[model samples]
Target: MSDTYAARAWLAAADPDPAHAELWLTYTGVALMPLGTNWSAVRVQERQGLRVASLNGPAIHDGPARAVYFLVPTEADWPGGMGELLGGPSCWLGVPAPERVEPPGIYWLTPPDGSGLLVDPVALLAALCEDGADR
Candidate 1:
């Protein structure tokens, strides 16, 4: 199977009903770094010179909430002590089906591209700090 297809399947497996477009609880293979606010999350994306759809890795946005979750490798060290790092066997993340990119519920802000690319922690921290300093 193609990488994209495999990646899609892997994510879809997380959903109890892969046939339906809905959010499901799944244990993430990656560590989830949640930004405190959507505003800051967007700022970090902008700093990376990437549009929402062009983010290097998968990111999830909680509906009507200030939170955004950036997916990074599970083995990655914490990102400079910035955000809370949630991962490991005990952590469960709400993941939307691979096809759920639009709103009405939790969705992918940036879907995985199958290359397993992830957001750089150092860059994320730098962007966040820059945004904070600008305030």
Candidate 2:
């Protein structure tokens, strides 16, 4: 199987550290899940300074595809804040956005509980690196 989108990387010196990036991705994905039920994983690589990408489409349900790609400048820099977003209370009650898009799927930074959004860029890049090695 092949994909419609094809992004590539050129690896060399000055690449981001893979160990730190992978740990951050794994930690954040687990931490970011609502109710500690984050059903996701993280992967990282070094091509352009801590790059991340997702290889699979999110489990979509009942609506349009909801996940969006974002350039997280702090992806390699975010602390363990993903858990805070999931475990903490909202600034307001009955916020509609998170609730609406949750089931559809999304990739969000600091997204709310059951938001049905995820961040898998690091995972994507990890897969790419693996595929590159396989090739």
Give per-candidate clash totals. 0, 9
Model 2, 23-135: lDDT tens digits are: 43344321122211223222122232122223233321212322233222122333332211222232211111222334323323223322233445555455445666665
Worst ten-residue run, lDDT, model 1? 31-40
Residue 3, candidate 2: how far off, in angstroms? 24
134 in model 2: Cα distance from truth in Å? 1.2
| Most lDDT-accurate candidate | 1
* 15-45 per-residue lDDT for model 1 (tens digits): 3454341222233223222222111132223
Off by over 4 Å in 1: 1-4, 12-55, 79-81
Per-residue error at 64 for model 2, in Å? 20
Ten contiguous residues minimizing lDDT sum, candidate 2: 4-13
Which residue pairs in candidate 1 collide?
Answer: none
